[model samples]
Target: MDCEKQTTEYKSLLKIRTGDKGFKDLSVTCVALANAQGGRIFIGYDDKKKAPLPEQHVTPDEVNEAVTKLRSLCFNVGLVASEICTDDTGSQYFIVSVSPSMHSVATTSDGRIYIRVADKCEPVRSEDLQRLGEEKGAYQWELVRTKYLLDGVALDALRQLANDIRKSSRVRQHVKQMDDVELAENYHLVDEGYLTNLGVLWLGTAKQRSSICYPATVQYIVYDVLERKVRKEEWHDNRLNPKELLLDIEQKAVELTYSYEFPNGLFRKQIRHYHPKLVRELLVNALAHKSYTISSDIMIKVFSDRLEISNPGGLPLGITKDNILHAKHRRNPNMIELLSALEMMEGEGSGYDLIYELNAMEAKNPPMIESSYNEVTVIQNAEIIDTELLPLLDFVLQNYQLTQKAFTAFGIIAREKKVFSTRLSAILQLQEEDRLRSYTDKLLKDNIIGRNGAKKGTQFFVNPQLIKNAKVNLKTTLKTVEPYVLRTLIMEDLRAHPKSKISEIGGRLPEIDLQELRKMIYSMVDVELITEGARTDRRYALK
Candidate 1:
């Protein structure tokens, strides 16, 4: 074989070491490759060289001995080695390709196991080992029986669970005829035909399971960077199924992370304060991949600077931080499948991609994913977002006629906050402008705001459709104004003239409110509703 050519092709998948003495301690490399996806090992070349030229010497006997030793070291696993070969110029090389075993392989004598992740080889933890064993059918936690289950435990929940499982295609086709006892036996929920800890946890009463094993619970805390303390928190136990739990938790997470408002004069229609699809996907991945074996629950930490989602589990076997975008390995396979079936999870594997795209579209840095021993975290920095806020604010500004209740339904405000007039008042103040005709006209001309209804019945909202089409150019400087007074002035102008010129409009307004009026007029100018001259005689007109 062309060793140099092969090495280039498989560089990312395998590690190559060559020109050393006969294969010494290749067992660790073998184990590491096995724990990960299988990869090839090439010998008889000087790999340490910047350009690894092939070595010119090799012994067939030594190669055979090395292969034998490696095979003997890894029980329940096998590897193949090729005979020593020479290139056209008498350069020597030997190739060994390790394949993934049906069974998880470990050192036969010492029982030590290692896995390669990125460039480092690390010991596989017991929990990971257990997961491997379960995947290989060597052992299952569901099979282990706990003596703590009480005899009189409620069977109602168990019956309901059985019904639900029976309805599923996998269980229906494979386990419909099997009764509760028989089904329990097949899943290894029974020990000598008796119910075990797995049965108690899966089918026992809520209170009973609480006594037997802690119910899967999740706690979320949001910290305010300014306050340096938790601003909000929520905790939930095993009330809903895993899929429902994920949805519920994610919704609550969005609530903690975002503040909503519908701004006017910026967009053609109303828009949400944040991208719902991106937020939902991130949280779903967190809940799906999190390690329940680790005692800590998934956490969503929101600060003024960033939003972080920390899941309990790190990368699963065969997955690393580098290849995470391409690799597919589900630590919670059942949960993943169930959520997928429920249509909560996207089919295209676009969760991470969506997060990245949203960040890019908003001109924010891409979200970051990090893995630790006990947790995997995804952090999305919202501090620098531009496009995200522009569309929503534009929508609110254009559709200033809509009531707070209607705006809230359009997703410009939180549902709970909508009920509070204080919050609504805050939203209005944040979105207000002094020049009604100019602001609305400019928003409509720019296609950032669109009109709904007709005449007095006409209302404005952020144009959801227009957001996708609008080129975002967010202003950096924060302009200060008394927004409530400006909003009142705009409403008064609209109620009075219904249509008016800038100078005519300016003549009717109070001098003390001129700053706010001028600011609103400038905003209208930016949106292109009116034309301006070099002097105060600048006029406004509908585009």
Candidate 2:
């Protein structure tokens, strides 16, 4: 039998001589493989390569009996088996491949649950199981019943929340006429006479907040990095009311700001270390999505140059850091709905988008998001030191029509003063330099940027006239600037890449049509400035 070492996708078991215990063990291993990414398991083969020993081969009948028993296990895990086959030495083995479960965790026949951790299978712990349940949306802490009774809910708190909701522009006018009980029902905070966990979190009395098993709180810390210790004022508050908790955090953050002034003639503009609106959006996310089942408090760390906020939960179900900008998954849907109705949360999933745009407009580094087993932390850098290009970026974001990539390329050149066209491609992390012209050429034709040097040493500099508000007319025909400029652009392409195809050259000048590109190439060949290789393997190069 062909064999390979055990890995995430492969495992081997020596169960040819099977018994009850061996079959149960094999069943548990199959459950784990199904929970994780699907993998193949070999039954009569040694985990490690071995010298041919007398094969303890099992008959097909025995393997078929084990497969029959596995079919009736706790969960219908996707499994397929290979027919028994003999090796060169007459040693027989069979393999079973388990596919990953789409939406459920697999379990053994006797009700034991396990998941693959590295190369081994381990039993799922209670906390991890709860997390998995949450991931599957099988359990919602907010929807769970709380011990607090309806009479125990604070009347004043409910009135205040009702008034707050009524004042929000997003809320319906009819909500203003509903009584406290009706209001709670409208928000899914109450079912029958029982106040759910969601109800207690929002409208519970002060006494009710103290009786919860795991109280929701925020821990605020301002660190002095040079001293390597928490600053003078550090505190923790257990505020069960999400609205009040958000307000308190915002007040605390106000103390952390420092301002600078930019003077222009008789007028002056004030800039804070970080934008308050952006900070509030981040706070709303941490408060609305934190796991209520965990005992941990939301953490806020303010440093000299950056601010970090973390909550006691990784990303919501189906959301990862790579897709955070476009993916919307809220762990506490109840809380998120309430917050959105109150106008506290902006459009769904727009927080990260706002953060990215704010950073780009300010010419600041983009925020960083990191996740671990039980937490997600976002670090926002506070410095806005790109004084020269800050105004330009602001204007571009506010007035210019540019795609995301094009805007990014514009920002890079405006900040760096001058860079090779390839450098912009590198900054964008694109593998091919040709894709960059789709962005840079727009700025070039508008005269917002001008080229310097020649060939491979070429550098692009942002035009000072553009910074001075000089209007650009980009509709002029290429015949006005085509002869010298187009030829130089092609020569620059050849100098950077000695042997490039015509299609690649066209990619670098996306503004020019394919027919126009062919005419230009032939015209350059006529002038002996460039040459095309044989038709069978067509490529262009500087003559």
True-structure RMSD, every candidate: 18.7, 11.3
The per-residue C-alpha lDDT of model 2 at residue 530 equals 53
Candidate 1 residue lDDT tens string, 153-271:
42454455556657765544657677766655655545664556556555555554455433456666666657476656555545554545666776666544464344446644333
Report the number of the highest-lDDT candidate.
Answer: 2
Model 2, span 273-340: residue lDDT tens: 67877788888898888887777878888888888899987666446465576567777888888999
| Regions more than 4 Å wrong, model 1 | 1-26, 36-103, 108-111, 115-129, 135-137, 140-203, 211-215, 232-244, 247-274, 322-326, 341-366, 383-543
lDDT of 1 at 27: 69
The ten-residue window of minimal lDDT in model 2 covers: 471-480
TM-score of model number 2: 0.62
Worst 10 residues of 1 by lDDT: 5-14
